[model samples]
Target: MDMQSGTVEEALDKAAAVGVTAVVQVGCDLERSRWAAEVAGRHENVHATVALHPNEAPRIRREEGPGALDAALDEIAALAALPQVRGVGETGLDYFRTGADGIEAQTYSFRRHLRIAKEVGKALVIHDRDAHQDVLRVLREEGAPGTVVFHCFSGDAAMAEECAAAGYYMSFAGNVTFKSAQPLRDALAVAPLDLLLVETDAPFLTPAPYRGRPNAPYLIPVTLRAMAAVKGVDEDELATAVAANTARAFGCPPPR
Candidate 1:
């Protein structure tokens, strides 16, 4: 989540105390993507995913020019090829923030990121927000990568079933612990263990008991505990499965 340079080591230390041995630093734009790659290269426990966020794609086109957006996408493609860059994303449709006019730019960027993931043989991390059907439609149209994870998956049980059928990994985040998120809990219940993943989505969607506070990898156990309860499984059992699932999804070794 944008830990200041001076504080990153402390954050990682906190995370390790809770048995959280690995972190995936997501890059939403060129600057962050480059930073993520550098950080990943420096930290054995950290891996990176690079992309132009769904909203960022349109914002770039609007603020700069179409050429600028193209250049950013080009850079993302190059970053995706990096050894420590394990995926291409945080990219997909986001109708909640972007207007209809931005839809075309977002779609084009999503397609490009999807292609980049496939080309690099890396995971495609999707950021679907208020556009589930379109996200599925686009994935079908473009053909998804071998490993596709719906980061901070927000879909319901039916959508979870759809994802399960496609063998897409559904990663649950801290928001799944909220009282208003029974639908998410329901989705978690029916989701296959092999397809399950847990994320902090840090600095946002902090779990209950810590809601309104900035989230971090250390808080992953909080969300994992909640997820285990929803799935009616042992906490350690769930954690083990999630670790394997994450490794499989990103084509990396499971965090020890």
Candidate 2:
């Protein structure tokens, strides 16, 4: 139920068949980060964003040792410097999964990831969940990088406006198509076209009517169509804007 159905090549081929040509493979740990970079290097249309998941930071400190987290961060920084590594993240707070005990470590890891992104002159991809204000505060305290994307953005309209004001990209995922996601729709409605992006957040958050199915890049069109409706724009127009916005957000060239 958790694993996706096919090989990476198959998924990419299917995605291309459906007009989802480019992808940013995200890594939430050291091993996956290395793999992501390798995959990106192998595939012209794929780019990588590497980071310790917010939850991973606290777990590493608690289980591995205090220094283990920093060592991991150092490796992530190195990976970020690679040409195929377009960003540093999926880093940021995740209060929903991490308890009060883990907050300090999570914040520290997030700040370091921020520094790495800036140092490498790359974009910062945030994975904020139920810690939106704190995530905003941290970015403000650390000074955000040239580009910041709130991956799988879960904020409401007011938050969207704030993000827009700060020139942050809010990337909507398949969950936005859910019937109960009116607030997400509201956020989408207010989000500027230039700041909008779409993602699969694969093997999770499958779009409506396919919620229980394993998600993949091929399903992006479903979410895009829903977002277009919420945004009150023609689907093709929204698609064009999103394609350009994604390239700008990740600092990657648009796919051919």
Give the number of the best model, judged by TM-score: 1
* TM-score quality measure for candidate 1: 0.98
- Candidate 2 regions exceeding 4 Å error are 1-5
Q: How far off is residue 200 in model 2, in Å? A: 0.9
lDDT of 2 at 70: 87
User: Taking the candidates one at a time, how many backbone clashes does each contain?
Assistant: 0, 0
lDDT of 1: 0.93
lDDT of each: 0.93, 0.92
TM-scores, each model vs. reference: 0.98, 0.98
- Give every collision pair in model 2: none
RMSD of each: 1.0, 1.5
| Number of clashing residue pairs, candidate 2 | 0
lDDT of 1 by residue, 1-256 (tens): 5655337788889999999999999988888899989989999889999999999989999999899999999999999999999999899999999999999999999999999999999999999999999999999999999999999999999999999999999999999999999999999998999999988887889999999878889999999999999999999999999998988888889887
Residue range with the least summed lDDT across 10 consecutive positions in model 2? 1-10
Candidate 2 lDDT, 40-111, residue by residue in tens: 998999999999999999999999999999899999999999999999988999999889999999999999
